[model samples]
Target: MDVSDILAAQAEKHKAIAVEKEIPLDVDAGFLAVTDPNPIEKESYDENVEEYLQSTARDGVQVLLSALFSLPTTSSPDGPLAQLPPPTTTLPRAKPLPKPKPPTKWEKFARAKGIQKTRKDKKEWDEEKQEWVNRWGWKGKNKEEETQWLSEVPANADVDYDPTKKARDERKARVAKNERQHLQNLARAQASGAERKQRKADIDRTLATTRVSTASMGKYDKKLDGEKKLREVKRKFEPTEVSADVEKKNNLALLAKIGNVPAKRSKHEGNDAAINVRKAVRFASKGEGGVALARRAEGKAARGKAGRRK
Candidate 1:
């Protein structure tokens, strides 16, 4: 029997995978993005939602895999690895671009005069040392005159005048000037109407504090012109000749306010009995109170004597 028909059937069964759609799938291997632009068939989707979705996803994945395999690959120990090209798709930035900083006075001046800023080399060539030495910092060329064995002094300079000290002082002055200018620029940049008003208020408050910080608390100090009168805090007290009834009420209110005094409940309050239980108890104990009655019932009359002996 001929097996050509069976072989042909088997060949048709196991063929290369191919997915066809109205629109092609856009695959960005660089970003690992696979977008399916083809519209879903309503009849197929309505028949089975889950299967339709899975089929659409499978087709997209198959297209992405095919695109990936088509790319050139480099051989490695493990296997061949394909290098993805730069992505063509332009994605939006997650965060907005940062705002430019406010220009400093020097920067503004440079821009105005069309002066291009240039960076100076940190290292400089030394003729004597025959090597590149730092222009500044850590035994730099700027400090060479101060550290040198011999230094030339001015002809008219005093006998006590030191050339090394002079050079060091000049360098320090330049550093101090630069720092002062930096602070000035910062202050200028940060200055505003609101800031000026706040600064003025701060100055006034400081001045007021200083005025009261004198030996006599500014009482004996001579007042300056245009100085506002400081507000004096006066303490008021109740009259010594207050009515007895009013004073008693005031004392009771103060005691209540401090939680020192408890409310006096009515005789029937919290007691369902017709007779006042408290009064009956007091009468039965002969004004000695419940403590005396309890001691008498417990037969502890000799408690005081025992306690005293102990």
Candidate 2:
């Protein structure tokens, strides 16, 4: 039976059982068919689809025209709607606002004193003291304490360098280098415009790469990323086909095709097969160039041997 007929039969069966049991439905879900009191009028019918498409096309065209017409003209510098400025009046360009300086204690005091600009710190020769005096920072405890701090240690004295002195110095140098690098990285991150984006991308690429281990430099770890995988030592397959097996006159041509050629120096030197291979070479001058020349020489040598034997 068709799906609708089957569904109707099932519904009738369910209705008959319900009536026999005198079953009363509790909710709308119990009913097979749902009734819509007032559904939204959707333009989904076959007859309305064409009209909907035409209406949409008209709306899209209007929107496109409105967008095109809304664009600002090159001739006008005014705000939206391309309004002109007052006649003969110059419009002053708005300058960029300067970054506000941080409020330091000295700067705050100077500002309180109504000073617009502060003098830069500089060393000057003091005429009264007959020495150069610093214009900024503490001079320290009356020069003698400073002299003691700056003085070199007496070599012959009981004082000696600590065991950790060298290590401390190295660590300090490393920290300084790291701090400078950190500053450079911070500058790149804080920078404005396209260069910052490129710098960030480069940083991300570096970070995405596998971290190399300090131990063995990945020499021991076979499974490490970016490390070369282990491969089995391959067997050497040479052209070892016998000349008698092929119809071709040239053994070298057979060797080229089959790739079964044997090495000249083999462990089985005293074997009968090796002896036969050596004997075969005397007649192998079958086809071209170097092989033909060598074969011709061998043939001549063999004929000479035959004449000597007689």
Which residue segments of model 1 deviate by more than 4 Å? 1-16, 71-79, 119-134, 137-141, 156-162, 192-310
lDDT of 2 by residue, 103-177 (tens): 554456878999789565466665756787765345522232333424454576455654245444665686798
Every candidate's lDDT: 0.86, 0.53
Let me know the TM-score candidate 2 reaches against the reference structure.
0.16
All predictions: root-mean-square deviation over Cα?
Answer: 22.5, 30.3
Candidate 2 regions exceeding 4 Å error are 1-119, 124-129, 133-158, 161-186, 189-195, 198-310
Candidate 1 global CA lDDT score: 0.86
Highest lDDT model number = 1
Relative to the true structure, candidate 1 reaches a TM of: 0.51
Against the true structure, whose TM-score is highest?
1
Q: In model 1, which range of ten residues has the least summed lDDT?
A: 259-268
Q: Which ten residues in a row have the lowest lDDT in candidate 2?
A: 25-34
- Model 1 over residues 68-171: C-alpha lDDT tens digits? 89999999999999999899789999999997666888999999999998999999999999999999999799999899898878899998999899999999
